[model samples]
Target: MIVKPCIAVSAAVGLTSSALVGALHASGPGGLPRGARGTATRGGQGMEATGSGFDLGDWFKQAFTPQTAAAVKKKAGTSTAKKAKAPSGRGCTDAVLVLGGTGKTGQKVVEALLKQKRDVVVASRSKESAAELYDASTPGLFVQSGVDVRDEATLKNKALFDGVTQVVSALGPRFGEEGSSSEAVDFQGVQSAIEAAEAFLEQGDGSSAAPGDQERVLVAPGDSGSDERGPGGAWQPLDDVIMGGRSSSAWQKGVGGGVLERQSGKTFGRWAGTLVTEGGGFCGTVIKDMPFDATGYDGIRIRVRGDGSRYKFRLKPDTKLDNTAERQYQAPFDTVKGEWIEVDLPFESFVAVKRNYVDFNAPRVNEGPAGGKMLSLGLVLSRFGFNEYPNPKYTAGAFQLDLMEISLYKKPRPNFVLVSSASAERYHRLTEEERKNDIPIVALNPGGILNWKYKAETSLRKSSLRHCVVRATGLIAEGKEGDESVRLQMGQGDTLSGRVSREEVGSTVAAALSSSYSAGKTFELRRDEAEDATGKTPDFTSLFRGLVLDEDRSLASAGGASLPLPPFAIVQDPPPPVTEERKQEILNDPRVKARTAASKKPE
Candidate 1:
């Protein structure tokens, strides 16, 4: 009767039998099911006797009736939905191991990695659970279970991380679990994973060797003849004289007798120049007709001895519009008088310049279409730095520089990429009102998750391996219609607060692994509700480039510092002034005339 119908409604919503009884009691006695009124009594207690009082026997009978079972089955069927499709791609060259891959956030990370065409290994405690969650047949994705971070032995198993070059620790703590507490899983577990990953990367392929030790040598000492890796053109002069400047320079093959001869009997190139600041203030030697492709290398390294003067090293790209004034990428380095030293010039440090003026719009030396194929190399003693800044060490005198070797070197990629919480820093700093408004912060703070995360981060920072820490704020689940319209925002000083989709966090982690700019940096990541999300892909290069390194002076001060303003936000200084007479002389020069005529007669 009415009681049976009430039981079906309660059971459909997953209510317990005790709750059903309470529901029936709230309905009047006149609304009871098909049981008679009870009148039974035992000792001092009144019992359910037929039609007189409440009867437990009749209640149980009504709760599990056929109608109640059908309602429960219908509810379960409605709740089940079709699973999303898994990513498909070819096997990846480099494998990335994802810890806690079965967790809500971890699955998003795995999905993002798969979309990036990276081989992904999901570490889980239950193989069956991971199998049910993901398509086992998908290429570039492998599931490895029994990976408990608490057990160092499990993490240390070599087979589990065989081809893994990077590790993304998405592990979160399991509260109230005996063995998987915050300290055990968050701090100690992450520390163990880092150690294991470092050992695997270093010992696997000798990536930890000194820079240029096992690398390809583009130019070797005591050799001028062309080899497979050396330049094909002979060293020549391309000084400011071409632009009507009185500055002059020469290149020769002997040691030129100084600390260089004393250290080695090997022959080296000598670049000696005289600076004349009257017309132009630069001198340089150039090597043309030689194409050098620096595809896999990170930067150039040169061994030189100089007269305590600052000089610029430049690379000219092979472009179709060669007759035009193509910008060259240049970076400055200083040398000690008569002392031979090696200088490292990373490709990212070089800026594009034409006629002593920097072109901020041009791509860096390591980027753009022609960046990989370089046509010429130049060594210049310049009176100017980037953006029209005067070089402090410039002097109008003779300068002698000795070059022993020139080669390309690669720095190792990050070994560990940790996905931590932004709340680790903001939880304690939030006001009472802020705390009340944020549910995640309120729930995570009392569990001491922040303390454990801080400990893990400190260990990672102190470790020798290259690392990146991405602290995400308020991770929102995928398919949140309200969140999809927001854009991603990154900041420092823990000052940003908002929701970010878990998928975006995974994409950020994948981007950080291959970027040298991301190494040794920690910043907060969130989404901006004010800005609408766009269809265009994010410029991760610019995003990583904008972040300040951990050792930057701004972050060392008390209370820390706010994020630096964007590159476009800063005011640019004016270019150095050029008089009409000097400009006319440069335009009328024989070199300029010949180049113009050649370009006009082009293909």
Candidate 2:
């Protein structure tokens, strides 16, 4: 007589009742009779043993090893596998230059960058001040004083750009100052930095992989006799005719129909047409099946010369929705009439819409695997703005938009990151109660700081380099020392009002440098008092993920309308009102006093 071997296995091995039954029938000694097979239970579907001499558990233990057990765990969808690692910084050697490095926020930025193990060059008007502020023995720290951004010659110093791949402009204007006015420091100073950065890109540092080299050029002038289609794919017109409109448009490649001409030994494309308001008013050109993975990019940068009219750059994601062709993500940009201008459109600014109406619940354009993938792109001259609003800059007539090149850029990595104030846009809308309760300088709008900061931001938006503008709310100046348990709260449309610590602001800026989520986007940031009690550290990734991209607020149609505020735990107890003595204390703060004193003298 043959004796059947007993088998035993742990339930944790993830073997199902069906699998055990199959194994028993296929591998059991002489196969168990049908009547002797175990019964399957509900829920977990575990098997019940019969009186048969064979033990399936013992057999499973003998058949499975640790590796096989792990495999089974994974196959059963219950494995505790580690998540994929996050993307790291550009490189270890890529130096970052920090303007105003000795200032309060700037100092915080410097500390955070050092913590990230990045090489930092501190640019200040006074080198001695920076040297005194930062430790001399600190690793990856360099101080370069006498580098005023107002003077174009000063920013052109080759030493500043040596190994420098990114720039963080923490510079702010001195209120009530003469030479150190907003135009000088806030606007033109940023302009000077952008020009210097562009010049640096043009003059390579002999490194094969330069900062701008990785740009994904979608549409560009090709060699003579080359195909009319660009690297972006075929160009076709999708005019208002589809909706029974009278508007007419076409995509002209090279010198076709006398619409475009060859320049600098290369040909260009033109989207020229007549936009009529009869029935509908819109003209556009699109390229379909253009597979572009804009995962680590800020947004699309276009070099175009147009008729001074506002035009919309639209995109459609690679999705299976039935109305994919009708739905799009668009951002409007104002064009220069006669001269060529490079418009940097960040991915965050693109608004989701269906048939020209804003869709608040629609999925973000860059919201899928690999950041996000695109199926098509188009340029539209439309009379309708978001949510059926009128395009304030729209004009109905013969129009021509000349396109030279289109490409994608990474933000804060190869771009300038500017730290401005949220009050720049909301100063005019502040409530009397808010003004009284807010910080002194913010309420006073000292030296027209609001206007100047807005001007500076506008200049950076129109510049050629990719950029991110972080508009921070009133900062909690006091108690920043040793208070490392703060959480961050961010919002769009400048509707948020609260106090954030300088440490949190600096941490946010440093976090933005390595995160693609912060590129080509603008938002208001503050500290979350409600979260302070949770004892959890701030999650910069989650904070940035909740932000919405900006639309061109310069448009008259895009007035003080704020987007829905991001979710924040309500603060049960608001901080006490600032007393008269407290206000004086804030004004007497070292940074504040220095700026106030400097305003009395000419730079």
Top TM-score prediction, candidate number:
1
Candidate lDDT values, in order:
0.56, 0.57
What lDDT is obtained when candidate 1 is compared to the true structure? 0.56
Compose the digit string of candidate 1's lDDT tens values, residues 445-536: 42355667667776787787667788876544223424333456777656555556557787888777666667777778866555356443
What ranges in model 2 sit over 4 Å off? 1-93, 174-178, 201-414, 428-442, 531-534, 551-603
Candidate 2 C-alpha lDDT tens digits along 1-603 = 111111000111011111222222211122211221121111121111111222233323322212222111112332222221111222223455666564446667777777765655544454333433445455444444456666779787664565555667776543222344455666677778777776663323322123443466766755334323552237777888999999999765445432366655555667788999887798988887677777556688988889999999988887663346667789899998887898988776789887667888765678633246777788999888877788888789899888877777653442568888775655444565775444434444433556666766766766776667887665542232244576567877666665555567788888886675666667888667583434557776667656554444344333243534332222122123445665455455443343334323332
What local lDDT does model 1 show for residue 404? 71
**Candidate 1 segments whose C-alpha is farther than 4 A from its true place:** 1-94, 102-104, 111-117, 123-139, 145-153, 173-184, 198-215, 223-233, 255-267, 320-325, 354-356, 386-390, 426-446, 459-466, 480-496, 527-603
